[model samples]
Target: MTNMLLAVVVGLTAGAALRPAVVALAIPAGRPADCPACSPRPAGPTVLRLLSSGCENCRGQLLDAPWWLPPAATAAAFAAVAAGDATGWYAAAQYWIAFLGTALLLVDSAVQRLPDALTAPAAVGTLVLLAGAAAEGEPGSLPRAVAVAVAAGVLFTAFALGSMGLGDAKLAVSLGALLGWRSWQAAWAGLVLAFTLGALFAVFLLLVQRRSRKSTLALGPALIIGTLAVLATGP
Candidate 1:
């Protein structure tokens, strides 16, 4: 009970910290410099400014991020902590995905693009944290994790030629590494679940006339959700 409450606090605080970055990065590519919604340089402490809403110059709400993000993040963190036996750096890796995946889900849903800025760092950090886990006596093979990540990236790259984006492939590398650290079956399950969820979502949109057959769906959120779901369900 105490640990779950702590997870809630940590997730909320981290989600709040992530808001400014999400607002800044959620813009379409090649527009950050001239984007009207991008907040100006903060005169006060950047952290305080970020935690506050609205652009300082125009007093406009930037990105209009939904109110549920922090609560969703808290739930995700609680789920991750409750779902697995991960400890040490392994546990850190779980929390990393829980928080950062929420950010990615928001950005991708808003802009239909996953910034390399976030994806690249996330992949590297997952790997580094997994390495730390290995060093801390976690019974996982780092080489297997790398191999699974590469394989997942390659598979997703193939899918990118048609239904997905290169960004999704990059995100896969990180998720694959995290899942593979647990077990090969977990990694495979995550991949399958991602595609299945994406397809179901597209169908729902079609049924509701929210999207057309020719419309492109953002796959990042599905992928992130699927990976996190696998982690939250146990290996």
Candidate 2:
């Protein structure tokens, strides 16, 4: 119970700390082409303020963030505990995974782009952490994770060729690694759920917002949410 509390605390801290990065990713580069007279805001200062919670320049802008941001971190802490991983290292890894996942989800939702910086590190780091977990008496799962990563990457690559962005495909690799670390079933379900949710959301936008079938939409949040759901509902 104490460990779970600690995990929640850590998750919340990391989430808060990384909020700036998410905000930075969401902000557009330079001034709008039509508003050349407006001074361009560098992402660095905004990031610093967002992290410190003190930048007047960024405080108002931060209001654009979804209300779920803080709760998602707390939920990830509960998920880490629910995974039945009692070790400190696993707990720490869980916190980081959830933190990074939330960041990716928020950034992608805002900008329709997932930065490689977050996705790449998340992929490599998750694999490493799961590898360590497997080393500590768990076995056969790491190979499954790698295999699922490859398979998910291939499937998403196909989507990227047509409907989805390559960044979303890359995001799949990380989510797949995490889900596949648990079981092949988890990996399969996560992938299915992600696309299902994304498709449903696209349909919703089309129906309600009058968006076209070819309208741009961010899919990363759905993918992240689905993966997190599967993680929380452990095998």
Candidate 2's error at 25, in angstroms? 1.1
Residue range 131-226, candidate 2, lDDT tens digits = 787778553377888888888889889999887888987888877877777788888898789879999999999999999877889999889878
- What TM-score fits each model? 0.86, 0.80
Give, for candidate 2, the lowest lDDT window spanning 10 residues.
30-39
lDDT, candidate 1, 1-235, per-residue tens: 6666677777777877777777766767664322265566444334534545556555466676675675566466656655664668877887887777777888888888888888898899999999998888787778888999999899989999997889999999999999899889888898899989999989998999678899989999888888888887763
lDDT of each: 0.79, 0.70
Q: In model 2, what are the clashing residue pairs, if there are any?
A: none
